[model samples]
Target chain A: MNPALVALFMIGFTIAAYIGSLHLYRKYRRIYTTPVIVATAVIIVFLLLFHVSYETYMIGGKWIDRLLGPAVVALAYPLYQHREILKKMLVPIMTGTTIGAVVGISSGLLLSKWAGFSTEIIHSIVPKSVTTPVAMSISESTGGVMPLTAVFVMIAGIGGMLIHPLVMRYSGLTHRIGRGVGMGSASHAIGTAASMERDTLEGSISTVAMILSAVIVSIIAPGLTLLLL
Target chain B: MFKDKAIIIPIQIAMLYLIYLAGKGIQNLFDLFIPGSVIGLLILFTLLSLKLVPEWILQQGVSFMVRHLPFFFIPATVGIISYAYVFKGKGMLLIVIGLFSTALVMALAGRVTQWMVKRREEA
Candidate 1:
């Protein structure tokens, strides 16, 4: 297949998949229905069935990936939009994110070790609670595979999406701030999506937690990795 | 949404691209470890706060992009197939521990923050 055709197909396939998955997610309301998760699954199946190389798919796939940076920058609009509520609870929100980062790293380190994974895998697991872009860099610097870190981040995220309500109900961690913080800090974007489903304020708060936790964890991940490992 | 406002999106993307470029430049110059997009976010926030970049200009575009931010991550997630071998051995074990720890982080950190908020109210 020609490179240009491959690129066009890749782009068309993803856009089509994204819209289709968006509908499926809204209708089916399942984790597998998540636009990103579903789109990836569909594309992977397409690649395998068609015998296309990942490299060829990446021709235009990379273009889609390139949008992440701008997408991230776009996040500031919401944070700014909710500036008033954030200002009132600024200190508590920061406190929640900071404490969440500490717990996330220490627990990730200890649990991975206790489970008998290698040091490298353990390192990757440490940043599992942080957002993907930040987690990828931390994982690479700390001797973990970047791709593996992405996987772990997704698992943690999807895990939060599934279990957060359970944790909130049974654990008595039901404060709205706590819910937002927990979801944002632990699950990042996936959890934020769940929070958005609940309320705009909840979603905004989760956004704050997600951004703050990423910054905090990235700053402390290396130093703590040195201390703990 | 961009039907008649086609120019808004292109302009918004261009401005965001410029902000992102400035962010990348700063990251390279300062040798920072943080993601350039984050710095770009801060820059956009500052510009908005200062009234330098009119909020209305970027409002619809940015919000639309942010709403579908998850879509931007699909390619990277699919790239996970590249690391399929890592899951062959104790990889499942590692994932279990990772997931368990993520749960703990949420429960514990959230509780701690709630405690602090209660303390502040009490005082």
Candidate 2:
């Protein structure tokens, strides 16, 4: 198979899976759940069954990954637009992110240690809640494997997607700003996307929180690693 | 309007490269400290906050990414294949811990932030 052609198939397979699952989700909303999740699972299974290499898959998929930085940079506009609201909530946002970051890293480290995880695994697991790119970087710096960090980040994202709504309902958090900040900070990008389904204000704030959380974790992870390790 | 679009693309790309360079510079400084991308994000945020880099550039790049961002995960998703063996040994435990803890922390963070904001408003 021509490499270029194979790449095309890869793209097609991903889109097709997404579309198919979306169709199913719309048709059977209650039973089917999120189309993206279903589609991602299907794609993973297909790839594994065929023994496809991640390198090959990425060659075709990197066109999308390259956009991540730019997308992150673009978030500035929404933040700019919401500058007034951001200014009002700046103290709460910063303080909350700091406390959340500390608690998150500490709890993971403490629990994993108590559970008798290996030192390396404890290091790998500590930054799992942050965004993938940052988490992978922290993992690399601290001698954790990139693949492990990536999987950890993905699990964190999915968990956020599944549980955030329930958390919101249980806590009775109706305010748009509060809800957005919570989702964005905790879940990272996936949670940010989930926030979009609620409203624009929530989405924008969530985006800000996602970006901020990534920034905060990246800054704090290394120092914390040294102290904990 | 036509002039604005004409002016925007070059400026945006230049800004991106500059941001990339700034990120690189920070990475170099922190080579003994942390990852470059993390440094890069911080630099980018600082630039945006200071208004040193115009909002238009960051806006164009961020919007494009957010809309089509999920596709980016495909590449990283490939990591699963490469590290299947590593995952086989302890992946399940790691996944469970990652999931539940992330949910717990996020919920707590959100609730705390909400409470703080409410308290501030009342005061």
Best by lDDT: 1
Q: Looking at model 2 chain B, which ten-residue stretch has the lowest summed lDDT? A: B32-41
lDDT for position A83 in model 2:
74
Q: Write the per-residue lDDT of candidate 2 for residues A1-229, one digit (tens) a residue.
A: 7888877887788778767876787788742266557767787788778888777776666755554554455444555566788888888877766666776787777777776788788878877777776788788877776777777777677677777777778877777777887777777776776676557677777776776777788788778867876
Residue-wise lDDT of candidate 2 within B1-123, one digit each (tens)?
Answer: 234655665466456656656665776776634334435555666777788876654565455444544544555554555655655655566666666677667766777778888998899
B1-123: candidate 1 lDDT, tens digit per residue: 455567788688777878888888898899887778878988998888788887888887786787777777777767767676777777767667767787887888788767776777688
CA lDDT, every model vs. true structure? 0.81, 0.69
Interface RMSD of each: 1.9, 3.1
- Candidate number of the best DockQ: 1
True contacts kept of each: 0.71, 0.46
- For model 2, the stretches where C-alpha displacement exceeds 4 angstroms are A20-32, A222-229, B1-64, B81-91
